[model samples]
Target: MSTWLPASPCTPPGCATHDGPARHPLPAAALLLAGCALALTGALCTPIALLLGRDHRERLTRAWAYGVVRAFGVRVRVVGRPDAHRGGPGVLVVANHVSWLDIPLIAAVCPGRILAKSDIRHWPLLGPLAALGGTLFVERERLRALPATVYAIASALRSGARVVVFPEDSTWCGRGPGGRFRPAAFQAAIDAGAAVQPVRVRYFGAAARRRAAAGAAAFVGDDPLAASLWRVVRAAGLTAEIHVMEPIPASTVHGRRALAGLAQSTVASDRANLPAESVHH
Candidate 1:
């Protein structure tokens, strides 16, 4: 692995422990089937979505993403206001990484070009779908390629495209400390003079009428994607909450490091404000 490549200490056995009721086998299977069908339907309609205008395409993507999450029996609750970036430059949407579900949850709210690892470009069904959706893949293993990747993102932002990135570079269990935001991606926003929209993503489950961290939704460490997917469907009352923080203008920040620090602090502070009882041990 590259020295600069982000890695997390979280492991499935140690961190991915569900604390909520599990769905019946039959229902879980049915939910999994429904989720797969919805994903296929979305893929089939991609050509048509591309033909529509930008606004129409955005609406379709958002609806499809929302449907996918719902089909998996996960409820979504979004807090805080989303910055529209009306009459301004493009906005870079940065959020904490937790689960694969984070992709759709974020898309349901803000449909944009996703910044993903280049390895995802070779994944099974998702690889093709991501290509169709105009995903921006970064070669994370090659630090020498970082400048070029940053340039590509800057170019996209300059064209007024909303780019979603997980600055953490690796997924966390969400129960413990999240990976810090790498300053590299923030440079793109600074280059394009774009606004930074920091979002905090948390998964919660029903626990005695109180919210508890939904470990089943985490895709951290070496957990198999299939196992995580199955766990998510089997989870009962799993809710993914997205907290959209105030947008920070890149031009106002002194440098990429400062901008990254501000955004990370903003997200961390919001997570800290959650009720003590809601946090899972």
Candidate 2:
């Protein structure tokens, strides 16, 4: 099949999408083969990351993920890069969650310790990888884990490391109704006087959407990592545009509820008027 190119700008149905072609499965196979080669490199580098201690290790892991994405033919275009100038002892980068791919994407943009669900800490390869990255595990029982979770986020922030959280608990397939946002992470920002930076991502191209819709996008959602990754590599390359909206100051927020409202509203607004050059804080 020939590749599809938009003579004019095309809008993504249901949600905003980028444009590319209907890639041949062979290309995806090649991408996967390249990915396997990278995985071998990871095996060699991971021990080095661990030996270097937690901080450097996670940074190396982030770089590895970004490299894998590049190998898979995923091009990430970041809009409104976060204001790193806003000197940060404690900054909370909060974003919408769509796929497990969010981790690598987030890591690429802002290398930070993630607040992953405790269950993921038990997964096969990912569980250990995440742990090696210094990810803070959060048990669903907020009461039982709230104190520790808060402490971990605080420490990471206080130590000059950013804390990335997906306010939305689960990944949305972009087909059905979306879910509500959990306020715990945002609340932590308010408590620690950290700025809540919001990032919105639009996975572009018809080929990408079909792959995502058919459960082929990279993420920890219902689709298995290996399978989803296979589909993404097989499809035409994807153009991902990320919008880093303005940061919300914790001082002005009442609590988590208010903070969440601000975040949700900001992301929704950005998506509605996407492809913007920048959004000032």
Candidate 3:
């Protein structure tokens, strides 16, 4: 019943898994473009999504996202499950930020209303898609807006809406310990009496896990979106991994800072356990 399998060459850092289908640049590009086209064409589902109940809407969104992930030729493996949390207010999922793909990767496993940066609302095709997918956009850069954003997330939690938050506030190379988890979002869970779920996301080569995360996987620095997309598709045998840690009950947790520290430590510790990954204090 466990999604965990025998250790994959990719699962352990530095292990090379040189066994799989031959990958080429052109084919990867074509597949990626086709996948994007497919997602765009599927826009009709949005209006339908609006009419569906909460559970149904979440399922619909997950299926759509998984489809896109496969189109990009990215294999995703999710460990742990979300159903573990007792029925209550929705959960607040906090994860490390890696690349744009993190969104779909998370959605495919446990689709929810993702709390994203506000500007994403204006993105070209993605903007419309996000709207249909029910993204909660926040202007994170403005200190004054933090309260409003927190309040919105809390309200959503109270309404039983699962919200995915990347508390890093920025993307990292994902090679070392990721950025620190910002505690602001933790307040939402406390305010709404929702559980906090800490998740760790990692990327490895599909066949040769020994190689570093595909250039596409890390969105740090000033990399352009177009280039990152191409890098991901072109990099053959890319696989993504997500580990869902145990949920910490808000009622049991003392303060927002303590909650944030616990979740961050949990995530950091999980990453360190990846045999191939090492983290510094």
User: After superposition, which runs of candidate 2 have C-alpha atoms over 4 Å from their true positions?
Assistant: 1-21, 36-40, 43-47, 50-63, 85-88, 141-143, 175-177, 206-221, 273-281
Q: Write the per-residue lDDT of candidate 3 for residues 73-172, one digit (tens) a residue.
A: 7888889987643456999999987778898888888778899878888988778787777788887657778899999999989988889999877776
Error of 3 at 240 (Å): 0.7
**Sequence-dependent TM-score of model 2:** 0.76
Global Cα RMSD, each model: 2.3, 9.0, 7.7
Top candidate, metric lDDT: 1
Instruction: Please give the range of 10 consecutive residues that has the lowest summed lDDT in model 1.
Output: 272-281
Cα-based lDDT at residue 167, candidate 1: 96
Using lDDT as the yardstick, the better of models 2 and 3 is 3
User: Could you tell me the lDDT of residue 6 within candidate 1?
Assistant: 80
- Write the residue-wise lDDT of candidate 1 on 1-281 in tens digits: 88968888778887676767889989999999999899888977887788998888888898999999999999999898676646556889999999999999999998889999899899898788778878899999899999999998999899888999999999887855588899998999999999999999988876452233557888988899889889999888898989888899999999999999999988888566554432324
Q: Tens digit of lDDT per residue, candidate 2, span 24-43? A: 77877888888768855774
User: What ranking of all candidate models by lDDT puts the best one first?
Assistant: 1, 3, 2
lDDT of each candidate versus the true structure: 0.86, 0.64, 0.74
TM-score of each: 0.93, 0.76, 0.84
- Native-structure RMSD, model 3: 7.7
